[model samples]
Target: MEAVILAGIARRVLDELLRNPYRTIELRSARNVMAVEAALREAMRLFLTYDPFEDVSTGTEGLLAELMEAKYLETRIPWEESDEREVTICRAKVKLVGLGRVVEVERRKGVMLARVRELFPHEMDIG
Candidate 1:
Protein backbone atom coordinates (compact mmCIF):
# COMPACT_ATOMS: atom_id res chain seq x y z
CA MET A 1 0.00 0.00 0.00
CA GLU A 2 2.89 2.33 0.74
CA ALA A 3 4.30 1.60 -2.68
CA VAL A 4 0.94 2.44 -4.23
CA ILE A 5 0.82 5.79 -2.49
CA LEU A 6 4.39 6.64 -3.45
CA ALA A 7 3.80 5.73 -7.08
CA GLY A 8 0.71 7.94 -7.25
CA ILE A 9 2.65 10.82 -5.73
CA ALA A 10 5.41 10.26 -8.24
CA ARG A 11 2.89 10.33 -11.09
CA ARG A 12 1.34 13.56 -9.92
CA VAL A 13 4.71 15.18 -9.36
CA LEU A 14 5.89 13.96 -12.74
CA ASP A 15 2.83 15.40 -14.46
CA GLU A 16 3.37 18.78 -12.82
CA LEU A 17 7.11 18.75 -13.44
CA LEU A 18 6.73 17.97 -17.13
CA ARG A 19 4.48 20.96 -17.64
CA ASN A 20 6.99 23.36 -16.11
CA PRO A 21 10.43 22.08 -16.85
CA TYR A 22 13.40 23.01 -14.59
CA ARG A 23 11.27 23.73 -11.58
CA THR A 24 12.36 21.67 -8.58
CA ILE A 25 9.93 20.54 -5.89
CA GLU A 26 10.59 18.98 -2.53
CA LEU A 27 8.49 15.85 -2.73
CA ARG A 28 7.59 15.85 0.93
CA SER A 29 7.64 19.60 1.30
CA ALA A 30 4.10 19.38 2.49
CA ARG A 31 6.34 17.50 4.91
CA ASN A 32 5.14 14.09 6.07
CA VAL A 33 3.61 10.79 5.05
CA MET A 34 0.21 12.46 5.24
CA ALA A 35 1.30 14.83 2.53
CA VAL A 36 1.57 11.98 0.09
CA GLU A 37 -1.71 10.63 1.38
CA ALA A 38 -3.29 14.03 0.89
CA ALA A 39 -2.20 14.06 -2.73
CA LEU A 40 -4.00 10.76 -3.20
CA ARG A 41 -7.08 12.16 -1.56
CA GLU A 42 -7.00 15.22 -3.79
CA ALA A 43 -6.74 13.09 -6.87
CA MET A 44 -9.75 11.11 -5.77
CA ARG A 45 -11.60 14.32 -5.11
CA LEU A 46 -10.93 15.56 -8.62
CA PHE A 47 -12.07 12.30 -10.12
CA LEU A 48 -15.29 12.54 -8.15
CA THR A 49 -15.82 16.12 -9.24
CA TYR A 50 -16.10 15.08 -12.88
CA ASP A 51 -17.70 11.68 -12.38
CA PRO A 52 -19.84 12.16 -9.36
CA PHE A 53 -21.29 8.70 -9.74
CA GLU A 54 -17.97 6.95 -9.73
CA ASP A 55 -16.85 5.11 -6.63
CA VAL A 56 -13.70 6.51 -5.08
CA SER A 57 -13.98 4.87 -1.69
CA THR A 58 -11.20 2.47 -2.52
CA GLY A 59 -9.00 5.49 -3.02
CA THR A 60 -5.53 5.05 -4.46
CA GLU A 61 -5.00 1.38 -3.89
CA GLY A 62 -7.15 0.32 -6.81
CA LEU A 63 -5.68 3.01 -8.98
CA LEU A 64 -2.20 1.93 -8.07
CA ALA A 65 -3.01 -1.68 -8.86
CA GLU A 66 -4.36 -0.64 -12.22
CA LEU A 67 -1.28 1.41 -12.91
CA MET A 68 0.94 -1.52 -12.07
CA GLU A 69 -1.15 -3.95 -14.09
CA ALA A 70 -1.08 -1.60 -17.02
CA LYS A 71 2.63 -1.08 -16.57
CA TYR A 72 2.23 2.69 -16.35
CA LEU A 73 5.59 2.89 -14.62
CA GLU A 74 8.54 1.68 -16.59
CA THR A 75 11.05 2.08 -13.82
CA ARG A 76 11.17 3.21 -10.19
CA ILE A 77 14.59 3.24 -8.56
CA PRO A 78 15.51 4.41 -5.05
CA TRP A 79 19.09 5.16 -4.15
CA GLU A 80 21.31 7.20 -1.91
CA GLU A 81 21.67 10.93 -2.54
CA SER A 82 25.32 10.34 -3.36
CA ASP A 83 24.43 8.01 -6.22
CA GLU A 84 23.28 10.81 -8.54
CA ARG A 85 23.26 14.53 -8.02
CA GLU A 86 22.62 17.24 -10.54
CA VAL A 87 21.80 20.87 -10.00
CA THR A 88 18.25 19.53 -9.90
CA ILE A 89 19.05 17.47 -6.72
CA CYS A 90 17.18 14.28 -7.58
CA ARG A 91 18.61 10.91 -6.59
CA ALA A 92 16.13 8.64 -8.30
CA LYS A 93 14.23 8.27 -11.55
CA VAL A 94 10.69 7.18 -12.35
CA LYS A 95 10.14 6.49 -16.03
CA LEU A 96 6.55 6.23 -17.14
CA VAL A 97 5.20 3.72 -19.65
CA GLY A 98 5.03 5.65 -22.92
CA LEU A 99 7.07 8.36 -24.60
CA GLY A 100 10.07 7.26 -22.57
CA ARG A 101 9.79 10.37 -20.42
CA VAL A 102 11.41 10.18 -16.99
CA VAL A 103 11.03 12.03 -13.65
CA GLU A 104 13.92 12.19 -11.23
CA VAL A 105 13.47 12.42 -7.46
CA GLU A 106 15.26 12.22 -4.13
CA ARG A 107 14.01 10.05 -1.28
CA ARG A 108 15.37 10.28 2.23
CA LYS A 109 15.95 7.17 4.39
CA GLY A 110 14.00 5.20 1.77
CA VAL A 111 10.71 6.53 3.07
CA MET A 112 10.25 10.24 2.70
CA LEU A 113 10.33 12.06 -0.62
CA ALA A 114 13.06 14.66 -0.55
CA ARG A 115 13.07 16.41 -3.92
CA VAL A 116 12.09 16.00 -7.56
CA ARG A 117 12.66 17.55 -10.97
CA GLU A 118 12.28 16.86 -14.66
CA LEU A 119 15.38 15.74 -16.47
CA PHE A 120 16.94 18.06 -19.02
CA PRO A 121 17.74 16.85 -22.54
CA HIS A 122 21.39 16.23 -21.80
CA GLU A 123 20.51 14.68 -18.47
CA MET A 124 18.38 12.23 -20.36
CA ASP A 125 21.23 11.27 -22.67
CA ILE A 126 19.63 12.94 -25.64
CA GLY A 127 21.50 15.00 -28.23
Candidate 2:
Protein backbone atom coordinates (compact mmCIF):
# COMPACT_ATOMS: atom_id res chain seq x y z
CA MET A 1 0.00 0.00 0.00
CA GLU A 2 1.07 3.62 -0.57
CA ALA A 3 0.61 4.36 3.12
CA VAL A 4 3.01 1.61 4.04
CA ILE A 5 5.67 2.96 1.72
CA LEU A 6 5.22 6.50 3.00
CA ALA A 7 5.44 5.35 6.59
CA GLY A 8 8.62 3.49 5.89
CA ILE A 9 10.20 6.48 4.15
CA ALA A 10 9.14 8.73 6.99
CA ARG A 11 10.74 6.41 9.52
CA ARG A 12 13.98 6.38 7.57
CA VAL A 13 14.14 10.17 7.48
CA LEU A 14 13.49 10.41 11.20
CA ASP A 15 16.20 7.86 11.87
CA GLU A 16 18.70 9.73 9.71
CA LEU A 17 17.79 13.04 11.30
CA LEU A 18 18.39 11.73 14.80
CA ARG A 19 21.42 9.78 13.78
CA ASN A 20 23.13 13.09 13.07
CA PRO A 21 21.16 15.61 15.06
CA TYR A 22 21.73 19.30 14.37
CA ARG A 23 23.43 18.53 11.13
CA THR A 24 22.12 19.94 7.83
CA ILE A 25 22.07 17.48 4.97
CA GLU A 26 21.76 18.11 1.25
CA LEU A 27 19.86 15.21 -0.24
CA ARG A 28 20.63 13.87 -3.68
CA SER A 29 17.66 15.28 -5.56
CA ALA A 30 14.27 16.97 -5.49
CA ARG A 31 12.60 13.59 -5.42
CA ASN A 32 14.53 12.85 -2.25
CA VAL A 33 13.35 16.13 -0.81
CA MET A 34 9.75 15.36 -1.64
CA ALA A 35 10.20 11.92 -0.14
CA VAL A 36 11.37 13.46 3.11
CA GLU A 37 8.52 15.93 3.19
CA ALA A 38 5.94 13.28 2.39
CA ALA A 39 7.43 11.01 5.03
CA LEU A 40 7.28 13.79 7.60
CA ARG A 41 3.61 14.23 6.87
CA GLU A 42 2.93 10.54 7.17
CA ALA A 43 5.09 10.15 10.26
CA MET A 44 3.22 12.88 12.06
CA ARG A 45 0.30 10.52 12.17
CA LEU A 46 1.93 7.09 12.48
CA PHE A 47 5.35 7.30 14.07
CA LEU A 48 6.60 3.76 13.73
CA THR A 49 10.28 4.43 14.32
CA TYR A 50 11.41 4.62 17.95
CA ASP A 51 15.05 3.76 18.11
CA PRO A 52 18.57 5.23 18.47
CA PHE A 53 17.61 8.78 19.43
CA GLU A 54 15.86 7.37 22.51
CA ASP A 55 12.36 7.99 23.88
CA VAL A 56 11.75 11.56 22.80
CA SER A 57 11.51 10.42 19.22
CA THR A 58 8.09 8.89 19.77
CA GLY A 59 6.53 10.37 16.64
CA THR A 60 4.93 13.23 18.51
CA GLU A 61 1.33 14.32 18.15
CA GLY A 62 -0.02 17.24 16.07
CA LEU A 63 3.29 17.83 14.30
CA LEU A 64 1.72 17.56 10.84
CA ALA A 65 -0.41 20.68 11.18
CA GLU A 66 2.57 22.70 12.32
CA LEU A 67 4.67 21.50 9.44
CA MET A 68 1.89 22.22 6.97
CA GLU A 69 1.78 25.83 8.10
CA ALA A 70 5.51 26.18 8.53
CA LYS A 71 6.77 29.11 6.43
CA TYR A 72 8.55 28.18 3.24
CA LEU A 73 10.41 31.35 2.26
CA GLU A 74 13.49 31.68 0.14
CA THR A 75 15.63 34.14 -1.81
CA ARG A 76 17.07 33.33 -5.19
CA ILE A 77 20.04 34.80 -7.00
CA PRO A 78 20.67 33.60 -10.46
CA TRP A 79 24.28 33.01 -11.42
CA GLU A 80 23.41 34.37 -14.83
CA GLU A 81 20.34 35.97 -16.31
CA SER A 82 19.69 33.05 -18.63
CA ASP A 83 17.62 29.91 -18.82
CA GLU A 84 20.09 28.05 -16.66
CA ARG A 85 19.43 29.59 -13.27
CA GLU A 86 21.10 28.75 -9.97
CA VAL A 87 19.93 30.09 -6.67
CA THR A 88 20.64 29.77 -3.00
CA ILE A 89 19.07 27.03 -0.94
CA CYS A 90 15.42 27.48 -0.08
CA ARG A 91 14.64 27.34 3.63
CA ALA A 92 11.67 26.39 5.76
CA LYS A 93 10.76 25.11 9.19
CA VAL A 94 8.92 21.96 10.23
CA LYS A 95 8.09 20.64 13.67
CA LEU A 96 9.67 17.22 13.88
CA VAL A 97 8.84 14.42 16.27
CA GLY A 98 11.22 12.65 18.66
CA LEU A 99 13.24 15.74 19.52
CA GLY A 100 10.03 17.78 19.69
CA ARG A 101 11.85 20.50 17.79
CA VAL A 102 11.36 22.67 14.75
CA VAL A 103 13.98 21.97 12.15
CA GLU A 104 15.16 24.21 9.33
CA VAL A 105 14.94 22.53 5.93
CA GLU A 106 16.48 23.78 2.72
CA ARG A 107 16.31 22.91 -0.96
CA ARG A 108 18.66 23.87 -3.76
CA LYS A 109 20.00 22.51 -6.99
CA GLY A 110 17.18 19.99 -6.96
CA VAL A 111 18.44 18.78 -3.59
CA MET A 112 16.84 18.68 -0.17
CA LEU A 113 18.42 19.89 3.03
CA ALA A 114 17.52 20.17 6.73
CA ARG A 115 19.13 21.04 10.04
CA VAL A 116 17.94 19.65 13.36
CA ARG A 117 18.46 22.88 15.23
CA GLU A 118 17.38 22.03 18.77
CA LEU A 119 16.62 18.97 20.83
CA PHE A 120 15.56 19.48 24.41
CA PRO A 121 17.87 17.34 26.47
CA HIS A 122 15.35 17.27 29.28
CA GLU A 123 12.99 15.39 27.03
CA MET A 124 15.59 12.67 26.91
CA ASP A 125 16.36 13.11 30.60
CA ILE A 126 19.88 14.11 29.72
CA GLY A 127 20.34 16.24 32.81
TM-score of each: 0.20, 0.28
Pairs that collide, model 1 = none
Q: Per-residue alpha-carbon lDDT of model 2 for 51-109, expressed as tens digits?
A: 22122222321112123222223445555666644423323233334432324334344
For candidate 2, the per-residue lDDT at 122 reads: 60
Best by TM-score: 2
The window of 10 residues in a row where model 1 has the poorest summed lDDT is: 44-53
* Candidate 2 TM-score over all chains jointly: 0.28
TM-score of model 1 (CA atoms): 0.20
For 1-127, candidate 1 gives per-residue lDDT tens digits of 1222233334455555445433333332222234334434433111100111111122211111112111111223365555533222222222232112212223334333212222334533211
